[model samples]
Target: MVAAAEVVACNEDLITLILLRLPVKSLLRFKCVSKKWLCLISTPNFSSRHRRLASASILLSQIPGLISHLSLNCSSSEKPFSSLDFIDDSAGVKLLQSINGLALGCSFHKLGKPRSYYVCNPSTRQFLTLPPPNAEGHDSFATVLGVYLAFDPSKSPHYQVVCVRNCSLSAAHDRYQIQIYPSETRTWRLCGSPFASPSDIMFETGVLWNGAIHWISPTGATLCFNINQEHLGSMPSPPSDEHWSKRRFRYFGESGGHLHLVEIYGPSTTQFQVFELERDYSRWICKYQIDISPIVDAFPEMVRDYLHPHHHDSLFYAFVLLFVQETEEGSSLLLHIPGKLISYNLRNKSFKEICDSGPKSTKTNTALHIGCFHAHQFIETLASV
Candidate 1:
């Protein structure tokens, strides 16, 4: 009996080590193996190690409540869509942004009024519905500039949810309202205004980097809000040869903890230009200008028949720039072209098609049917909301 117990203890230690390296999704399932195993996997130390080893995926959501996840590694075997079970079907859930494994979701009522906001950890299937902000006078027209999630459960159990509201104060002027909700306090309060003048914050392409949330204004300036300090700042955007009004196909994103700007232009709409902000955010440096002519040349039939000659004029209505992945293999850009997803590798100058099979069939879909979809960088974590 003594010898058997010693062997069991040794096996348990070996199992724990092996499980620590697995992804959070697998660990969540393994928790049902035994009570002892559940306790081990539920530890803070185990959760931290699991997060470090896990890779980030891309979460894609379509209008009218369709959510899916795609692996960032571009694994073909991965399912195109993994349904989010935590969200209720009746509730109209719209994902705002994701940070440190926690996603901020805005749920609207039947009449389209601003409802409650939920911070959810999709991997762990845990979520917390935050108390609604004080919206006494603010109505549905109050533009939600952006919803930022400031949570890292690994460091501390507490988290914060910030909502940037831009409303019309006058015909020519706008008011910026900053609302903050801390987990510890469980209450929402108006922090303060972050902008000096009436500025239109681009919420669709907001990127969180360097402990701040950034958005590009119509004037070609990057608006920044420090999450920790709750202060606002502005930085210059990338230089443009054409007028600011003429340059429309620009997106703000982050890669390798650095902010990047992607501008797609040219007559054929095959020119891809990427810029990286300096460490001090003073100026922008042109990283690369990839000519996608090789890709277009490869598929001459598709380019000649399907590709629009003047796509650059209405790029947003046609194509969406998905997440950018910088890996050991190479840097690649994921782009949503109508019904299909294409990946362009910067190193090899090659383009590969990605599969997008969701709950409904996409074989006969078109650009109009695909509509507007949101994609975010998603990392699996055992963090609680």
Candidate 2:
């Protein structure tokens, strides 16, 4: 076999072929191959290509799987996830940004590792690298924690990105700090807000809809920030969960053309309660206690495969994605189990694993948190295991 170092110096096509076959671990090491390869892997164009491949969506593969997916795009797979797609794992994810298929990451071996680098489709065998957002004095404290990359579908193809930071609340400061980084400008603009701070971890378990990014605050406050409008505010709160261990950001999304949040019982981690915010300021309630676990009583043999296993690694924590799905009777949502890219139907209350048993070479786990912008794109932590 050709040495990895020699492979990097080869022509682009050969390098791309080798990358497509290697797993995440191998890709990380390949970064040292050469400066050019490093630069190539870090570009925005490569990210878009990578997204298309790993999702391996057939544009038309009739996998009885994702059948439970409540996505509005549930029809034929003919259309790609739209050309311009921006994906980030959590609202609190500062260092990672995925836009138009490219994932940008902040790399710092020293003090604060701000969002500086970007990773393309490690699976697509392409990538691009951009300079860090800023090389300022506060580079130690300024962090790109949460990201929102969006393209306007109503108008011509257009996209924007927002990188937020929570600075310290000193005597001179009362609210948290936020920063906006638009791809069109390639610069960071500082904006002080009514709420935000460096120490706070804005819960990712909120909703992103109508041009705003939402989050569940640590103290149970429903928080939201508008990326286009550049404003911070709060949404209405629901009743408390009796169980505290499960007291994390549950799933929040827009369904049937309405804003919604799903609250599940903690500890039990089985039952899910749905809350929909209405125009008049009232909530629509729908609750379903799902033991999607492998408990035989919960699911029969026919649908057993839909229930996948989380890695046995004790260090890893698993969070289930429960979003609103559309149903024939009314409207519904489904739960997306990590590792297994399948969406569990809330209507039938059944799960369908996308059974494309092809070898997948992904940059990160499939179970990343869900967002509103597009499919297979969500906010995730950058600190690798």
Number of clashing pairs per prediction, in order: 0, 38
RMSD of 2: 13.1
Q: Relative to the true structure, how large is the alpha-carbon lDDT of every model?
A: 0.68, 0.44
Estimate, for each residue in 299-329, the C-alpha lDDT of model 1 and write its tens digit.
Answer: 3422432345565343333455666766665
| Residue ranges of candidate 2 with Cα displaced over 4 Å | 1-136, 140-142, 169-175, 192-207, 242-246, 253-259, 279-284, 287-319, 322-342, 357-385
Clashing pairs in 1: none
Q: What is the C-alpha RMSD of each candidate to the true structure, in Å?
A: 4.0, 13.1
Off by over 4 Å in 1: 1-9, 23-26, 72-81, 140-143, 153-157, 167-171, 193-195, 243-246, 300-318, 355-361, 366-371
Please give each candidate's TM-score. Answer: 0.84, 0.52
Best by TM-score: 1
